[model samples]
Target: MPRRTLPTAEDQAARFVRQREADRKATAEDYVELIADLLREEGEARAVDLARRMGVSQATVTATVGRLQRDGLVETKPYRGLFLTAAGTALAAEAKARHDLVVRFLIAVGLDAGTAEQDAEGIEHHASDKALTAFARFLSERGDTT
Candidate 1:
């Protein structure tokens, strides 16, 4: 076995920047998916309801919702609930598919169901499409989708 050296300062900074971008994208994806799910489950996605489900302050939800609207992911009408734009719905579907792939890969690697679900939440955000595709292939080769 070979030992690895620690990351350099420059390497750490670059990685941090990349990770922050990924996290930002993940947050956007998560909000869209949550809105879609809430709409399906409750027929609405109000700021208050989103805050409750996300465990964040109403102010935070308002700010993020504003950003989403600006990004053309969601639309809000006065006195009405939140709604996903076509772009938002597409992103939510992609995020859901990616999450499913990550969870399946973790289970195929022998993680228990609970742990795989928990770990997939983080991995799905950070995993590249190439990596996820490879994971899907691995699972398919084994004839296992669960």
Candidate 2:
């Protein structure tokens, strides 16, 4: 077997950049998904609710929500609660799908349900499309759809 060369510094830096960007995107997806859930369960997604769910302070939530608004992902209605725009809705749906797939795959591999749920929270955001496809295929082959 041929020995693989180590990644150069530039390669490492590029990978870091990509990972950071993915993390940032994941944060947005999580917020939108939570907002969608809150809307479904409570008819509204207030800043306080988001802050509580996210385990962050209201100040942090406000800052993040401001950035999301600027990115056209969400919109505020003054006294009304925050709402997702069309783009945000689409992103949330995609994120939710990924999360479900990851959680299911983890459980199928024999991980405890509770551990899988926690592990999936982070893996769902970073798993590659190829890996996700493989996980789906593995589940399908097992005749499992839970």
Candidate 3:
């Protein structure tokens, strides 16, 4: 039998910090991504629509949208739907790319498309750039063009 070594306190703390940061960003990423999708598909993103799509209350959507505005990611016009600032658009594009890459990697590893998509929702948020690059290399090695 081999002896197992536990992580040091510093290592554990760093790991927790990484996870917490990811957790905090997940909601913002999801909102921006959804907003981008809605704008592309329907040409508008309203608080009511976001609430419906997110399965949250309108008040919740309003609160989060306020935070996003303060962060300079979004803007609102009187009687008009929500609009993404340049920063928000860039973030949304990046988030969507990461999500798509994760889904493709999962599928290439033999998971079904539905399962891969569901799993990628969480995995995309937590995966670092290095991890995503490795996944891309693995897919490339496997000759997966799609």
Model 3 quality (TM-score): 0.95
Q: Worst ten-residue run, lDDT, model 1?
A: 124-133
Task: State each model's CA lDDT, in order.
Answer: 0.92, 0.93, 0.95
TM-score-sorted candidate list, best first: 3, 2, 1
Residue 11 of candidate 2: its Cα lDDT?
97
Better of 1 and 2 by TM-score: 2
Error of 3 at 138 (Å): 0.6
lDDT of 2 by residue, 32-85 (tens): 999999998999999999999999999999999999999999999988999999
lDDT of 3 by residue, 45-114 (tens): 9999999999999999999999999999999998999999999999999999999999999998899999
Question: What TM-score does each of the candidates earn?
Answer: 0.88, 0.91, 0.95
Give the per-residue lDDT digits (tens) of candidate 1, residues 1-146: 89989999999999899889899999899899899999998898999998998899999999999999999999998899899999999999999889888888898899998999889888999987788889999999999866
State the TM-score for model 2. Answer: 0.91
